[model samples]
Target: MLIASSRPLAAAFDLALVDLDGVAYRGPEPIDHAASSLMAARASGMQLLFVTNNASREPESVATQLSTLGIPAEPDEVMTAAQAAAAVLTRRLAPGARVLVVGGAGLLTAVRAAGFEVVGSAEDKPEAVVQGFAPELGWRELAEAAYAVQRGAWHVVSNLDLTLPNERGLAPGNGSLVAVVRAATGVTPVSAGKPEPTMFTLGAQRAGAHRPLVIGDRLDTDLAGARAAGYPGLHVFTGVSSARDAVLATPDERPSFLGADLRALLVAHRAPERSGDGWWVCGAAAARVVDGRLDLRPEGDRTTTLDLVRAACGAAWEAVDTGSALDPGSIPDLAVHEA
Candidate 1:
């Protein structure tokens, strides 16, 4: 069930650990309302840390892109999975340990900065292998990773996200490439990105935030990471997951709040209330699952579509939790449509 906050999210939380790829921008373009909403949240005294799973680019590059997209960002305020992976390696390996670098310049930069001797080939007898994502990565790089892993070098990956949202559509993420290496080597690389809690914890610690909110579009990586880090998450509809996905989310993937976009941070959230007649109500929107079918009724014209979505998710989640199997066909298309 979604949690209610009497105060606006920007006021309630000290910092927002925000995901970059799908929530703020997809590839080179900015998502609608993202920049302005984040600016407003900053005005309300909430700090922002752009936490990203995309480990290809360095922090300075990411910050430059965000500034170009109308969101002012500093390099120090951006945390990349590459940085986390480097940190994870530093904890286990000695300084100047030879590391077989896979992926792109970002991974190389982080490893070098962490006092690791970066090597290009498995024949170097590197102490470990560090892999991240890069658009140009192909068979040659993956093969090197596989070889190193098979030779008993420690394996560490930036993230395990299977798909990355780009301007065209979802593309194979680092996780897909990691899977290729794992298949050949028969060894699972240690993940240091989302769903592991490292990035979120690092962001919160840097921001000095006691009450941090994780905001992202993906349920599996973003929301799941938030749960593992002992923080609440806010899922927005601007990316991969949809309203239908939210209703069917597993217990660990559920968010504390739902919104159409980053703009929701400026408003208060009201949780759906379960009525005596088995209906879940949010404002004037009501929904229920009866005989495996979800029924949604907007009681009045004033009912917002997002509230209707909230109500539906509440009803569906309750039904699923109580041993009632919902018909997948019964779930309505609750995607937010822009005029």
Candidate 2:
């Protein structure tokens, strides 16, 4: 039996179901300090699972992307809405049950991997119909899904996100597809993502976490998922969410901790200082302080800071490297300082 916490934000829960796209990365660029934040959480002995509502990509692919972005992750560390949908069908249907999949390869792969037989055509007459976001969705596919549902096949959908963000802008998401299927069949498919408990349960079980902290940038999915899973979450403003959104969010959709970016959060957690002009190491990043200047640098990135103390330290280090006497006035202002 799952127990609900009276003070959910403060309560130390056993697992975290973190979203990927809008939470950790936006397009191909990793959100600022995303790698460090995960490293910090892992260092604190928190189990982490990367959960996503995007059913377009498989878990292995998602893991590969995370690894390329300098984050240590494996295929098993990732969870997608398609996986949740597959679990639902696998638990409800008999092994080798025929399933009509109308989505991307991710959904199809998960369904087949779960021991379900995929039907190529409506004439195949599946026992279940699974729907997700498919850019190639045509009228024929919609009609086929509707027809399958009408024939008493169980219906399942990956997520209900009305729009998915991309570098171009918001585009039609799984929710739009769900609406089409619902209008045609008059059947609301079971949602398997975000604000749904099944994804969190599966994530926690796989991660084997006793206490976790959810982190994300979207209020609707990541924050909602954390609340539904009864875990505390940290919200970063570097993605889809804004400071205004955080202030106006409902209790369930609001995060327990808020930060401008992932780096700011790590700085606050590790080297919190009031008055100082020195360098402080936080995870793999080194924050330096020079004569009224500050600089921040991650392991592989150039060192720069906005804080005066960190800037001074960086300047002194540069002087030492060139075998020149440290002159505070001669040090140039760090170019990478940002609020």
**Top model number, TM-score:** 1
1-339: candidate 1 lDDT, tens digit per residue = 799999999999999999998899988999999999999999999999999998899999999999999999999889999999999998899998999989888888999999999999999999999999999999999999899899999999999999999999999999999999999999988999998899999889898999999999999999999999999999998999987899888889999999989989999998999999999999889999999999988757543377888898899999989999899898877876421
lDDT of model 2 at residue 290?
47
TM-score of each: 0.97, 0.72
Model 1 spans > 4 angstroms off: 301-304, 337-339
- What's the lDDT for residue 194 in model 2? 82
- Model 2 weakest lDDT span, ten residues long: 1-10
- In model 2, which runs have C-alpha deviations exceeding 4 angstroms? 1-16, 264-339
CA RMSD of each candidate after superposition: 1.5, 13.1
Q: How many residue pairs clash in each candidate?
A: 0, 21
What range of 10 consecutive residues in model 1 has the weakest lDDT sum?
Answer: 330-339
lDDT of 2 by residue, 194-287 (tens): 8776787788878777666677878888877888887666666666766545533555675655555554334333222323444554335554
Give model 1's clash tally: 0
